[model samples]
Target chain A: MAPEERLIAVGVSHHTAPLEVRERLAVAADSIPTLLTRLRDDGFSNETVLLSTCNRVELYSVPGVRGDANGLARWLAETGGVMGRDVESTIYRLHDQAALHHIFRVVSSLDSVVLGEPEIVGQFKKAYRLSQESNAAGPVMHRVMDRALAVAKKVRTETNIAREAVSVGRAGVELARQVLGSLEGRSALLIGAGDHGKVVARSLLGYGLTEIVVANRTFGNAVNLAQQFKGSAIPLHEVERYFPRVDVVICSTGAGKILIDRDQLAGAVSKRRGRSLVMIDLAVPRNIDPGVNDLGGVYRFDLDDLAQIAGRGKEAREVAAEEAERIVESESERYWRQIMNEVVTQRIGTIVQTADAVRVAELERLRSTLDGLEPDQVAAVDAMTRAIVKKLLHQPLHQVRTWAREGEIESVESLFTAFGTRKEDDV
Target chain B: MGSVLTIASIVTILVPVRARRLAQKNNAPGGIAAHRNWEFVAVGLILLGLLLMGMQSDVLPMLTVQGGLRTLALFVAIGWLVLRRKEKMAAAGMILLPMAAVLLVSSLLEPPHAVATSVGSPFFTTHVALVFLGLGGFALSFALSTLFLIQRRRLKRKQFEDIGQLPSMETLDLLNFRTQCLGFAALTAGVAMGVFLLTQSASGRGLGDITVWGTCAVWFWYAAGLHARVVLGWRGRTAAVFGVVGFGSLGAVLTVVTVVFGGWHGS
Candidate 1:
């Protein structure tokens, strides 16, 4: 069988698994090449691509002779150092058309934690690139991934699903704009220079924030983050000192206790003299004191609040999302059909070539008897034999295509074998 | 004909208000564009009504109460249109449009009075026009301040879902400050012209009259508010509060002088 005919996908995503399961299965970018090589060398798949993002850890592969969907799932579980039984329920396995549809949906971000997010496309491209570097993905994966990317591009251009701020950091930025008006001359203080805080700071800068002040538990991290924006950094302990000057304060630290209390924010508000302040708390276990929200001239939003804002964006893009789903559905169906047709054509060509070889061998044996005939008569005999061979092969070729279309692949293989066409005969 | 146009303008303004509410409900951008387009149509209707009133009147429209109310609506509409050009000031229309509608309705309610032929001097005419223009400024400031307070409340309460399309509190405060300054200057000049005419005439109207005291009181209130904003750095909630109160007092004094005490300035 061709590698494309044995396509399979096994994964645990945000929808099917909890965050803990996904985290366990998630592979780092630097580790992806090793994983891809292992997948191919260990005989799990002939061609494979590993897509490991924060929201999902998916493996798209075409299994080899010793490989199957269950084997791929077990391999994934072994890589994560988890028991197969522990993740068996969460691991979703798809095959053939269903697998292709899932790939299209994932590349288009329709299967993301946040619908229509743009980050998934880049992550998918990076995964495909790493697969190529590892020499694990061959022509089959290249064709599938390239077509997936084209579908994603079409969905992005033809729909408005990605037009609004659906991600948490971006939604927080939108809420900040609502409270603080224009951010052109405004400044933001980012507490704990972590990835989430960096993302929020980048969004704020994108919306025209002039300055960013970073404060981290580690002073070097703070300095590094601040230098990226040409801003300043302060010690984590001195965050309250800069509160009165900045228009927004984003708290994304990992500290388990309250960082800023009501009294500290009250003092800041007093110094601000009625200038509005927006506080976004993106940390878990509640970094900033929730009571600080009661202070006048101060607006505070935590993760749940940001999620609600993001939900509003999702609601706004519902119409666009419907359009995108239709595009994915139609594109996947068309692409799958084309792939099936190519397989059918290859099988039919093999059958025809075997029959023609038989005819040529028989005609060679009759060359002695044809030596007495004229050149024109000899040509007629050759043409009549070729016509006879074509007429004899027509019904079998038609039946092969019909069986392929009806998904009776076993019957098609039996017919090909009965006609003396072997797998090794494919050129 | 003027009343018809005014009513049509009020109805037109309601279209954008409804569109705004629908937009907020559905979280759609198309509704907002529709709201903005309809708002323009509403303002155009107000302008057309004002032009019709101008062409029909023999003397200046500022000579009577109905004309004064119509003039107030026109000025408020014009002020709203001008501010709408600079920013997303659509939320201000929630208050400003209803205020204009009330002015128009009030004009329709008032009994028609003869135009004062003896008060035909250009000085008196310019004074009345400036006073109404100043009141127009106050009305716009009041609308902006009201929106500022609503937005402030939404923020303080952390009711982000209800914020809708209101401008930032800083933008509202700044626009209120500018409008207050313009209103104060125009009222000051108009009051000066009233004082000059009072001194030259034998009409017996002076500072002792309740209307004169009332007008002066309105002037002093806005003057103090503007002074606090500029000199003491009083802004945001404070400036918005002052705007609301100043306009309230001005409305009260106008009602008492016109409705209870009859006309002022020896009318």
Candidate 2:
């Protein structure tokens, strides 16, 4: 009989648990090998793979899934320091078909916090690589995961999933417009001249924002930037000086200290007679302090924090998201059906082999009894015997095929395993 | 028997491989005409339809085979127009092929001028053949000229878009002049054979006749355009416009003459 295959996906993720749980479960980049080994030792075979991201962590294994899932759930709870009740409830367990569906969803960006975000695909590929390096991926998981990535790619290319959404920079500008309510005669202050900052500045310029004042660390550089876009330029030192005059402060600079702190911003707001200020900090270290987010008449968002206002993208991308989901479901079903096909094929091979052996023995016995036959007669008998075998096998093979297509292979495979004399071989 | 003869005819036309090479090296990469992928299918259908003729029930099979050929041509043009993305020429080809197909079908149904009288009819048949072949050649030149004209306009205006995908101008001009020369040869042959057929008939043959003179006039018009293209260094819009006038004259003579005669070859 053919070998059995099982797929298990057990890990903590945002959908499965809180971010705290997922953070603990995340396999660090450097520690992937050690984690893979630990999981393998605890009994995940060569088919184990770890997919860890900031928002989710998922482990996929093949060939004995539900049983393997229990082992993974226990291991994760102990290692990631989640309580048993939390592990039991939050650690989402999926076996065989469900594991495939989950992988498809993750790759399609449906499971991401921001729907239709293009980042998850690259991240998933990197995770698959780490699993490969750790020798934790086998044929079944490999095929399923490869198809998952393929489905995600097809969705992005064939549908408008990626382009329909607003970019983070544009979203920031939209938020600014929302906060200011109008850009009529309001001067927007653009700090730094980076790619993101320039994009937001241009988007602001597109929305009837002509009185934009630009300030950078390099004053002449700021003037070069300003003249190119027909906006006023300012000296970097006079950035805070103009803060009182501008209605909106869009800071995206590389200052080590807090460039737009609450105290300095408060003075600017007081001077401007409590006029609203929208600060879009698209920097890693954060150009504006997070404390300013709650300040009166102020709306601030850092690079990571941009996604919340990026909901405009969600509204735009909803149309494409439905199509992407349909693609994922179809591809996921195809993968599982292929898996079931393998199950049927394995059993069919064993049955055909056994039947052929028995028939060949009986034919040999019959040939000896008909030894008086001429050479051509013997050859004809041989051809007839082979044809008889073919006739006998065709109906059963066709039934097996029909069973495989309809997903009745699991029951039929168990029957074959019971009938076959060799239960010891690897499948 | 007819299939064998048609096969022989095609082999005779194609034996040098020079004519096929000449056709390809001229056409650009926008359409099936350029690729010549239908070399096997087009020739194969001709052989098949010819083979079917007279080897079976005559009129039904003849009309059926001809109908199939028309359908094949239409399908080929559509595939070229759509999958090959050569919409303009396909539209133009569509406009011309049905005319020849309709005349051929009607001739087939009516015994093509009575077989008992078909002896002298071959000359007139050659005339009909010349008209159709001339029309085909003119269509080819027109397609090339239209492309060249578009490219020329785009160049003059410094507007690169909407120019038909075609060979470079030098290539297109050469193709236009060459195809005009071929059609001129065929039409000249038609006019000569047509005069021969008129004289072979029992009726008094008049060479200086008006309609006969009209066909003669078309011959000179094409010959003059050919001279203008080759010697006068006329090119681009001027050459293309002249070719259009030449083809138009030939078309007018064929239509008006055929209508007067009731049809080409009196069939």
Candidate 3:
């Protein structure tokens, strides 16, 4: 064999770290190639994938360096510009089967902040593509990712986990409906032209929204999206100006800075005159400021709050997730077995090839001695030697295969060494 | 042989009871298989009855009380298949098929009188066929309404047990209305033919008889329900409630006419 290689994963996710730490660690899309190259150049791993999303930043690798978990953690902390900043406490390292199980869980959305959400699969696919393009993802990663994706698809199809809407937009709309009773005749203001903003607007329309106002940094983009929903468009700066006329506000802008602060929203709340104002901030850095929630009659929710609303229907999904986890476990076990079998088969093939080389050399050395004898005598001697070799090798080969299958790799390796067939010898 | 077939038909119809219980337990494949088998066997038994009656003579004696109920059950089975093609109506079938079995078996328990031979008039045969067929249609409507109400309650509570397989409330309402319309037309013609035949045949059972009055009351109630549904645009829960009440009143009238008045046509 090719020396025992294993699947490994190291990561920091929503469960282990706060949003402040996650935001700092989140890798930009363009920097993935450089990070992957660094992972290879620095001897972190032979096959690596850096999965950076809003809720998590995970690195999956194969043929991982032994006893280098702490080193890898320090490298990741340094890359995220948080070295010596206590980021080490939040990092986790997994190896072998635990690493495989972790990847399955992540792909199936069982490890997601919103349990059973579908966005993580697409995010993981993007990370896979990045690693493939950078040539950091080798054959092992290719197999692991392909199998992980298949497991994710099977979980989605065979379970009810993906049936419910677990998006921030859907949850925010549900929360608004609960507070306001009905969405009929309700007006909503979409404060960004982003996809998530459109999702919330669509959810509002599904609830019987009468009107929608779209506002974006680019006024033309706002108008383009507004036409689809049959809503009006406004410039980004003029968003708060129309908030008083709308019942709900959804914000998901690309700007990393907070767009709606308390001072700006306080005036808007005053304009509403004690009417309930439901504002949802779906951006990573939060487009709407937290301080806006303190104002009277203004209900502000960030991604965390949306996660809570999404959990309302989680009991049903929990049952499905359990079933999905079982599928993952079974599939992963099968894949691991297949990998071990392939390794054992390749080792046996090498041993057989070396034995053939030794038999050919011994027969050539005896060719001159048989020249003086009759052709029939030479043929008989050749047949006797072949039969002796076959009979002698059969039981030992069978025992080695059985040992390999029984997970006694050490015994099989020692057997190959004892036979002196582990190396290439011409004689 | 006829009694044996009737019992077999009843047994076949009761198969849906087991099928429905299996469905509720989430064994959908097993439930579906049992339901399909039940449909085949029940329809076969009813057809066998018709065939045996025809085997006895050129003019069959299938207008008797037991034979008429068997014929009604056959029509209901056909209706079930037709509506199933249009929508998911397993819940309606689950309730309606077992009731058809009970009624068919009950009809068989009546004393073996030669009522079919006594009422040998062609008009009497037509009246019995039409009325029982109408009753079959109304029973289907009643079953659909019951399912509609159940589904509505489940939807209101957001508890979706077997909701994926059951028909929607709207589909059930539409089907209930259509079946009621068909039943009303059939009942009207049957009652009209009976009255005309009574006048011409010199049967002493006239308008004064409680059976005739009860039949008239049943006709008028259905006519009103149909009229309210089409003309007043009454639908959903109102139409569902109306269907249940209309079918119940007609059933009560049927019991009184058969038991108390001793069945005006032949008994």
Isolated chain B TM-score per model: 0.88, 0.59, 0.89
Q: Which of the two candidates, 1 or 3, achieves a greater TM-score against the reference?
A: 1
Which digits, one per residue and each the tens of the lDDT, describe model 1 over residues B129-203?
888889999999999899888987877666777575677777788899999988889999999988887887776
Interface RMSD of 3: 14.0
Question: Considering only chain A, what is the TM-score of each predicted structure?
Answer: 0.73, 0.64, 0.80
* Ranking of all predicted structures according to TM-score, beginning with the best and ending with the worst: 1, 3, 2
Query: Model 3, A1-427: lDDT tens per residue?
Result: 1322266788799899888777677776678999888888877777888998768888887634432556667777888787775788898977656788799889989898778887788789999999999999988889889999999999999988898637756777766764454688889888876555677788889879899999988899899989999999999888878877788888977676789889988887766644567788877656888887767556676777667767767888888888888998888777766766666576667767677677768988988887898989978888887777777778888898787667565676678778764422210
Task: Tell me the tens digit of each residue's lDDT in model 1 across A1-427.
Answer: 4433467999998788875576577676778888887777777788999997656889998887667888888888888877767688789989878899999999998887567877788779989999999998887799999999999999999999887538766877888888777899999999985455677789899999999999999999899888997899999989888888999999877564578989878887887766778898876445778788777667888766665566666776777889999999999888876776677788788778877888889989999998889999999989999999999989888888887777676777788778766543331
Model 3 bad stretches (over 4 Å): A1-5, A63-69, A84-86, A164-167, A189-198, A213-245, A253-257, A358-427, B1-267
lDDT of 2 by residue, A343-382 (tens): 6677677777887787788878887776889989888877
C-alpha positional error of residue A360 in candidate 3 after TM-score superposition, expressed in Å: 4.5
| Each prediction's whole-model lDDT (CA) | 0.80, 0.62, 0.75
DockQ (0 to 1) for model 2: 0.00
DockQ versus reference, model 3: 0.01
Ranking by DockQ: 1, 3, 2
Q: Which regions in candidate 2 have their CA more than 4 angstroms from the true location?
A: A1-5, A63-67, A166-307, A361-392, A421-427, B1-267
